[model samples]
Target: MSDPHKKIARKAELSKISSSFRRLSSRATLGAMVAGAAVLMFIAIGVGEHLATLALRENERLIGNDLAASVDKVLDGASTSSRANVKTLPGSPCIEVERKLAELETHLRYVRTVALVENGRVYCSSALGPIDVPLSAYVQARRRAKDITLLAETPFQPGVPVLAVFSSTTSNSGVLYIIEGEYLSDVLVHGVRYGAERAAFAISGNGVLDEKGRFHTAIDADAPYSTGVTSRAWPFTILVASSPSLMTRQRWAFAVASGAIGLLVAGLIAAMYLLAFAPRRLLLAAVRQGLKRKEFHVVYQPIVAVSDRSVVGVEALLRWHHAKWGPISPAIFMEEVESSDMLEEVTRFVLQTALAEMSALTPAFPLRIAVNIAPRDLQRKGFVAEVVAAVRSLPPNTTLVLELTERFLLSESALTSAAFSALRAEGVRFAIDDFGTQYNNLDLLGRFPFDYLKIDRKFVSQVDTVGADLIAGIVALARPFGVKVIAEGVETQSQHDGLESVGVPYAQGYLYQRPATAQSLATSISSSAASAQH
Candidate 1:
């Protein structure tokens, strides 16, 4: 060494340079963190605004439904009264009928007038004055009512508010028409204004503005007609117009609050990054700790045969227990894993655990285990080989059923087809889960091999009067394919009977048994067997 003092000075200089570099790096990191925080804040604000708008739209839709139902009830009552006495009353009883009609008019004072049509003429009225106008004139004037045979609201005149309710009665002789005009301006001015605190408007089927009328700018240029609840019903639309300025004000307030919060978060992140790398290090440490713990588990749901009510299969469903979140549904956590590369690890773990469980059960029943395969996993390189290896390692008696859902099947059809074929070669079964959901390509069904098709729970459960014909059609289609049909969500005895009668061979639903642990399943089977023996 040239000199001991020189060596010390050199070391000191090196330490000082290192300290300066660290300070510069920390400042750069702080800037990046601040930028990232600003981006995240912007994203959150966008999502919040979108969700709020969606909520508002849904609220409007629900309110409209409620209003429609209430109006329908009123129309029903009026129609009942009109049909009950219109034909039976003689000319002498006209006075009595007029008195009754006057009382009915009082009952419906909110209504402008109620007109009854018989023999293609306006025969009776609610008003006490003599009916001087010709029936033909009234009929021609009320041609709009003829177009809307069902109960509906239409604007009678420009600016003047009116609601038209039309109903028809069919007897052995011919059809009789009843029409009632109700003033909706009072209802709109009082009811809707009080509730929503906004200007309200309604429109008729002919695109005529109601209440405020043709002069009002409530109706937008692009407003479309509502097909109503029934398809055969006339085209009618409801428009509720409010001040656009109020909406703008609310949006501006939300934006300002969001921006302020975003700026504050950015400042906090900047400060933290400038001070230390504590937050990043903490996150990495937490992730590493989680991987080491190996706390993920799975729950099983039994799939029973409908005809015999025997446990034929169990679907292995993933479950996660976060130290903070307790038990989390797979639908959520699986999505997070799927977005990352850790999904393969999760699949391997599930496969191993499920196989081990199957091996452990003494005198293993001839049961199939259905596992949902994510499309991403199928697309992974060497995925098929890995799955084959896993299957080969499993016990001979265990039958693995791969359930490909419509979402996964729709994308990468060719890849999924190849995967299915390869798995089938290894003695594994394949099923199209939630079948009859969407219009699937029949050509694909013919070309690709599928062992079973699980009918969607919605279609299966609705095998009553409304859906009876549809269910019959589906059953008929499946019959030729020779593929066993398994109906899901058979909740009631009536539903079970309906499916069984319609040739649904198998089913999985709560009516038979809910999902249970391995031990609980065994106990359930034992109880069921005991009951059978008795």
Candidate 2:
């Protein structure tokens, strides 16, 4: 009997070892599969980006070549027309020469003026009645020496720059044509679909001409993906500069294709995780559906003055009620909302609902409604306008305040600053929410003109100890800027008293009242006001 018992124990031990070995083997296989997939994804992205870059470069080169050929054809026509009719131009009557030149000018669109230079002066002209200025100052000696040669020069016609084409006919006289350099800009840019930021221009003999006919001494050397081609007929070079959007379109196309392929490959390698991840996909789908159905709501937490313990305003918070998941916390869903394009929808809903509901439940004191804004929201072009429209329905004597955290304000952009200034002009106020958590708080404080700074709960929770001294320092620091200091998370009477001793004028926490529905808050405020009258 003892021998049989020992044999049974040995078999059990062997079975345990086999299970451990299988587990280790499974983990190793999964690691190898993940590493292999990452490498393939990296290679695919690199190849796609490389191909896109090549395509953009090729397109730029083609543009240069086409522009150069078009200019050459126009110049050739001007040179040929003058050479064929130079004999009749010289020694002819000024009226007869002007009539013939005018006829030539009518046939060509770019020829602004045509004249015949006799000796050192212009003898006759198609546009100008008669020329008295010396022609030698504008044209080179070679134009007079050669039998037939075309030369371009910079001669100011009025205030605009004109390209003077000197075509030599004989030693005594030559055919002179003045072309508006600005017209070249229209010719080059016609029917082209370059992006808004793109700059297409031409450079000739130390002078640059933009698409709008504006002239400069130099081109923008810092333009990305820039390239140029020299004209085959003349010394002019056409330069093209464009943004990375030209290639990003291709990169996106390849990325989407690779992503679909990667998903299929992953399903084959690890079917278990794919099946497990299905629930997450379902949850995301439900959240999307909830947004469409208007299953989200807003709640307000009363921000009471530490000095009076009465509600001065309320902070707006979003609440989501998933049909299957019951009540979902804002902390869990807000990150997801911010990551997707749904952030603007959520912000508009909260801002509209908070202002409308709170405006109707106006208390005795001026009700100030504070709304939290994410950094990405301010990056949009119409954010300032949107905020202005949202607060148009506010009740009389009420103020709308925007609360921004220090992290977002530290790297405050020019657009963000402009938005703040514009909103401030419209009577909207701003506050730095959850201050003192980041190292750049002082930098942001110095840069932006803030009306209030709310201390983070982490600092306010330790009010009896070092937190009290820290709060005092913050209040003193903000004293000069005329910024009010408010402490958050005043859960107990001791914490509130300590903060008040440190001169904190305002706070928001459960000790005064927790976040409640708008209707409940309206009733609570009315009851408190009646009690105070008694």
Candidate 3:
């Protein structure tokens, strides 16, 4: 007999462990989700900042292009006026050339002084009545210089920086015009209003004129992203110093929104894991693996007639020789499985194996092979078809009897009745197992068509004292329905004798035979055949 106390204690321990595991699993899941979400959020923010900086860098390049266009416009106007207007000065007298130079100076934009240079000599000026200065005094010497020049100071105004533009009319003669430095600085400095922090204009080799009207020989190279746009119309470049502060603001805003999205996705994944895949996964997976590994098999216990003890049939009982646990009692696991969906897999394993094993036998007499089934399997559509397939595999000498173990009621509806009728036509039979124990057996017998009633083991164990009168009454009640009675668990000779005294016809228990493997049964058959031959 199985140890009932150990089974109860094992079940209680498993329940307690399952509860603890569930709590631990839930907390671990939450922590993992939070860490995963945080990682995703940080990655998203980093990527968002990178993309935003690229866009901002492109924007700054466009702003520099726009500023370059403005500088082109101003230089284009200055170039046209310096050549066409200054050449029209009177050439007759010095005083007249000086008056014409002053008038041209007053009309030209950004011009400080206009002078005439002939054969590398500056002879006249606009600000002074007469002047004598070499052409090289204001700029580097060139025979036909048509370029810009930077002057830090003049003889008259001591320390005022100016630009000299020479537009040549001949190889050695050209008009010399001086331009104000402040106006050039103003055009370059306007970039501050757009995005740059510091703005300046750099001449080819002279100096850099900054936004503050000051000049330096070299510009700062360490400034972040110092952008330069060279003028196509002049011999200088516009430079602006930049920082990432412009894109920083927009990057942070986009990062916050992306972080929120990451959290929502993590929450959805965690919810799906808990709801759809976590609970009961371990037990179900183990059962599925157990089936694949062929850990389960069937055994048979012979049933004998009460009068002469002749072996008439056998009841097929499922036995599990687990690889890890080694011979688990069905009582410990069956209750849990009956309450779950794995009951069908277990039932089909026993049913198919028992039928095939019984069909392989060539016994001298007809044999009844009974297999137990749970009530829930009858409600399935494919169940009847599976049974029909297994039943057809048997030979004519063997009969298959299904004993219904009613953990739940097998409904007596039209659909179920049709299923039973279809199988009954194929010579399949039914027995109500453990009758008069968990439910009202008399009501059950009237509701469904049954061929046999198996008396529960509790009644058989106590037959001499309490169950003797009860078995007599149950056998009397079963007589009108044409139902036969089988008393189970007949352990002693006196119990068997008592069953006979009560007129029970068929029985199965340890007093007659214990459950044995298919190989054992075959060995017994071979020995009996050898004895008969002698």
Candidate 4:
């Protein structure tokens, strides 16, 4: 070819080839991006479904626990009635026994009738007044051994479901209390909160009571869960479950939103990952590491009796010192740790270390050692056993008080109630910390068994001001509930004097002594013992 003409043609051909290569590369890049987006969405859908299932299961479990607690609370009344000691004998005139029975029934809530049994026969009744029915007719032969007998119908009240609670003063003499089924059914109806349509309360093959209060002769195979919650105080179990279709709907709803996010989020995953996990992860990991390195310790602030100004108890407070970050205020890292699983470990560390420190002192006087616990710690596996073991480890003269801090409202579940009952039985006491500041203050006192109510420091700080009326009101409110009031944050003599004037029995704060180390607390204890001896 000629040199100039050939060069022009070759340049044009080169340009055409370059343009084709650019078009192919654009198509391939677009295909890769589309594939990545699809993969991201698929992962998002799977993760969303998994999370939804977990959330639903947790909700079901919580509701089930609550329902069990409610049933226990109801039955607890009848159980108390059965144990009543009345001077009116079973063979006494129907009117006198009926009057006594009616009086006793009024004292026991949810109780319909209080009948007296003599020689295995019902001689005096509260509802029918004189009755001559055999106790065997009401209590089944097999169920007679237990405290409760479930009756689908009674001879006097036909077609009514009732629980027969028996307490024996002697082998032949006892009290029989009737609790209507409708009251228990009310608890069941409100128990299913998270999209669960069917809920039932059953007592070990005796019968099932549905949300409608209809008593079934037998438990349905389908309604009861493989893991139903059983009440510790009573022989009842709760069933709670969301429908399969509802679960599928939940998964799909979560999946669709997650898939849409996945399409837009693929480009920003790195930033989002950091935002989701950085601060919590970094701080939580440090806390875990700090625990292992013994960077955490507890200090005790003396809780004193307001009248006598004596060191009655001390509350254990946790402190941490990070190697890299220096001293970290619990206010900063604890919030991060508390929401994470690592909170369990931090709580255990503080509880165990605090007890160990107190054991070393073993002062002559009986000192109440108080430790704060998170709400989650109460329901965790081995929690009650852990506390019982710690309680046993303490000296007989020393008392251990678990102060439940009100960072979150503590849910009253059967498991929690069981924990409280077991520990309280073991002589371990409980106190509701930060009392006035939380939501549902009255509900907490009424629901849980607390030995003392610790007034939130803010109220104590205002003892010299407007909060005195509130303080007096709190003390008065606690009086009916029988929970002794202890004020926290007594910073001045005037505040202390105001707290005393308002009927606050006990208090703790900087006014008496700031939080001290174990060594200091031990020395103070020895001094207090010496003073008491003198």
Superposing all C-alpha atoms, what RMSD in Å does each candidate have to the true structure?
14.9, 24.0, 29.9, 26.2
**Tens-place lDDT digits, model 2, residues 1-534:** 698999999999999999988888877777887987787677666766666666666677777677667766666666665568765576577876777888878776677877788776777778765656667655544523332222334343555755566766666677777777766777557514553234454544446666666666666566432677787666567776544675577568766666666665654445444334445555456567887888888888988777767677788888887664456667656666666677787788888888878876655336678898877787866778888876676766567888886665537678778888888887788889988886656666778878889999999999977788888999999988889887888799999999999899888899988988887888656644432210
Q: For model 4, what is the alpha-carbon lDDT of residue 113?
A: 86
Per-residue lDDT of 138 in model 1: 30
**Residues forming the 10-long window of minimal summed lDDT in candidate 4:** 269-278
- State the TM-score for model 1: 0.44
lDDT of 1 by residue, 10-73 (tens): 9999999999999999887767776798687887688657654554445445444544444444
Q: Candidate 3 residues 336-386, lDDT tens each?
A: 677788888999899989887867666633567899887777777698999
Residues 1-534 of candidate 4 have per-residue lDDT tens digits of: 899999999999999999999899877766776687778888998988888888777767788888888777777656653453552365566766688777777788888888888888988877778888898876655334347777888998899998787766567767777888888778877865556767787778677878888888787775655337877777777877776776788888888888878865874653344335456677677778888898998998988878877777889999887665455568777767767898788888888988888787745456788998877777889888888898888876678888887656567788888888888999988898898674656778888888899999877888798888999998988888888988988899999999999999888999889998877876666666433311
lDDT of each: 0.57, 0.71, 0.74, 0.78
**Runs with alpha carbons beyond 4 Å of true place in candidate 3:** 1-279, 363-365, 523-534
Better of 1 and 4 by lDDT: 4
Please give the lDDT score at residue 110 for candidate 2. Answer: 78
**Candidate 1 vs candidate 4: which has greater TM-score?**
4
Name the regions of candidate 2 deviating beyond 4 angstroms.
1-285, 362-365, 527-534
User: Candidate 2: minimum summed lDDT over ten consecutive residues — where?
Assistant: 143-152
Candidate 2 to truth, TM: 0.46
